[model samples]
Target: MLIALSFAVGGLLHHLGILRIDHLPPLHAHFRVPTFRLLPAAVFGLAAAWMLPGALARLRFGRAIALGYGTALAWTVLLAVSGDGLAAPFTHKEEYLAVLPAVGDDPSGWLAGFTEHLPGYPTHVRGHPPLPVLVVWALQALGLPGPLWAALLVVLVGCSAAVAITLTVRRLGGEDAARRALPYLALTPASVWIATSMDAFFAGVGAWGVALLVLGRKRWSRLLSGAGAGVLLGSLPYLSYGLVPYLLIPVVVAVMVRPSRLTVAAILAGAGSVTAAFAAGGFFWPDGVLATHAQWAADPGAARPYLYFLFANIAVLALVTGPAATAGLVGPIPARVRTVVAATLVAVAALDVSGVTRGEVERIWVPFAVWVSVAGGFAGGRAGGHAGDRRWLAAQVVTGLLLQGLVASPW
Candidate 1:
């Protein structure tokens, strides 16, 4: 119902000429000639939806992580291949790889002048920090070059977000909640973007940062885990300016866990180290934010009507999260899980109302989307019961397959 309403609203806006999107409303995608390529993924998703919920209930924690991650990875790859083949990651003109050649051999020099050269770069490059391009550039320097390697790196790392989210849920809500959430995390509609978009890489990194922070609250590994979380969280701003709002996620984690002062200090030290290193390399975080904001404001796409997207963005979120998550939002969730969901929503709402992210949130907000979708784990009966869980999981899988078959997205 929410999904249909979103499209209907988007269609009306498009018809009225009030929406400035280049592609279809509510999504940055076009209707494609339907293809049989989606059939294999459909079959796989149905099988997992039917089987994994029960199997995950009985599996050991270690084995569950392995199985869950492997299944999620396979699902993302199949969906991505179904849409654009192995070349999907680099296919878009605005993607990071498209502008990799522009970075040249002098990374330090480029980092120093990133803001000055921002306007001349491609759309995706100009709108983001230097980290994404730097990752691709590092791959090339390591002899693991080209779009295929970059795409593989992204999918591999991106799919791991499922594991990270699962771990965080387990820490906060217990093993049952974590186990229940696994299928949704693995089979989310968000996988459509996670398969090919660089934003998926950001989602994975941000999720693990929170996961580590919660997991690190223990006495033995506080320093190591806090430091790890800090570095990953700190690096997020450089990945996407939009992720600056993502700080709320970690703040929520910190409050929930109530870490010792040493743990907190370790986190600050780790984050400060990244800030220092970047400053030494000439890419101050504040400059990147200002420059990206300027670039975004000047882009014609930013001209879309804010009034329409203010609501339509929620619709796109529904599409990405699917019915299970939507239902879970109202279900009886654990306080910790609910708190995390609330924090993510606050961040997303802040972004939506700010008029900075007018559309394409289906891909751009992947990091927050995963957390929002965590509500799905609580939608069914208590941890051990299968009651309504499988049905909702099936709905999520079908939603992904339908989206892949029906629309051709920019990712």
Candidate 2:
């Protein structure tokens, strides 16, 4: 109903010329006629949705991770191919690869002047910090140059976010909860965007950062985990300023785990080192944010109606998370996991009203979307048995396939 209302109201506003959504209302995509190419992904998704819930529950933790990650990778690739082929990652002129040549051999030099170059760079480059381009640059440096390799790299990292989310759930709610959530985590409508967007890359990084922090709260591994989380979290804002809201996730984890003072220091140290390195390279994070804001203000897309987007953004979120997550949001969530869910909702609400994120949140909010999808686990668990779980999982899979087949994403 929320999704329906967003589209109805948003479409009305767009038709009335009061809202300037460039593509579709609530999504930065257009309608497309799906071809025979979609059949393979559709078949695979249905099979996985039907089979994965039981398998994830019965398999050992290691095997479940393998199955979940492998299936997610295959699903994302198939969906990407079904919609736009392998070149989809670089097909858009505004993507990071188009701006890679500007960096040349001196990444440090590029980082130093990133803010100054914002006005002239393409849309994706201008909006983000230096990490996305640097990631592709690093891949190129490693002999994996060109769009094909970059696309594969993005898919590989993006799919791994499922593993991270599964681990976090296991840490917080126990193995059963993790297993219950694994299928939904592995099969999500967000995979439509995960196939080709840098936002998916950010989702993977942020998810792992939070996962490590949760997993690292033990006495023996606290320092190591905290430091690892710190580096990933620290690098997040550099990847995309919009990801700043994700910082709240770790705070939720810390409160739940109650880490010692030393662990806190380690997290701070890890994050601080990344900040220090960027500063040394002549890029201050705050100034970069200000510059990006100015660029965003100048972009014509900023003319989008905020009042409409406040609810429409959440509508896109519902589409990405699917019906199962919606059921979970209102269903009986476990006490331990409730805080994480609450934190995620609060973050999304904050982003929605901030006016910084007007639309296209389907992809931009992928990080939070993963956590929100965790609710599907509880929804499945309470739905009776494995059959109920499979039904919910299938719903999520169908949502992804339908979106991939029907929507032509700009990414």
Cα RMSD of all models vs. native, in order, equals: 1.6, 1.5
Residue by residue across 1-411, what tens digits does model 1's lDDT show? 665777888888788877756467888778887588888898899899888988888889999889999999889888988878755657677778777677778889888988898998888898889999999999999999888888888888888988998899888888877888888899999998887888988999999999889885456698899999999999998898889889998998899888889988989998898899899999988888888888888887688888878888888888888888988887778789889999999999998999888888888888988998889877764642565777888899999988888888878
Scored against the true structure, residue 234 in model 2 reaches a CA lDDT of 91
The alpha-carbon deviation from the true structure for residue 226 of candidate 1, after best TM-score superposition, in angstroms, is 0.7
Question: Which stretches of model 1 miss by more than 4 angstroms?
Answer: 217-220
TM-score result, candidate 1? 0.96
Candidate 2, run of 10 with poorest lDDT: 17-26
- lDDT of candidate model 2 versus the reference: 0.86
Which lDDT values do the candidates have, in the order given? 0.86, 0.86
Candidate 2 at residue 261, lDDT? Answer: 90
TM-score, every prediction:
0.96, 0.97
Clashing pairs in 2: none
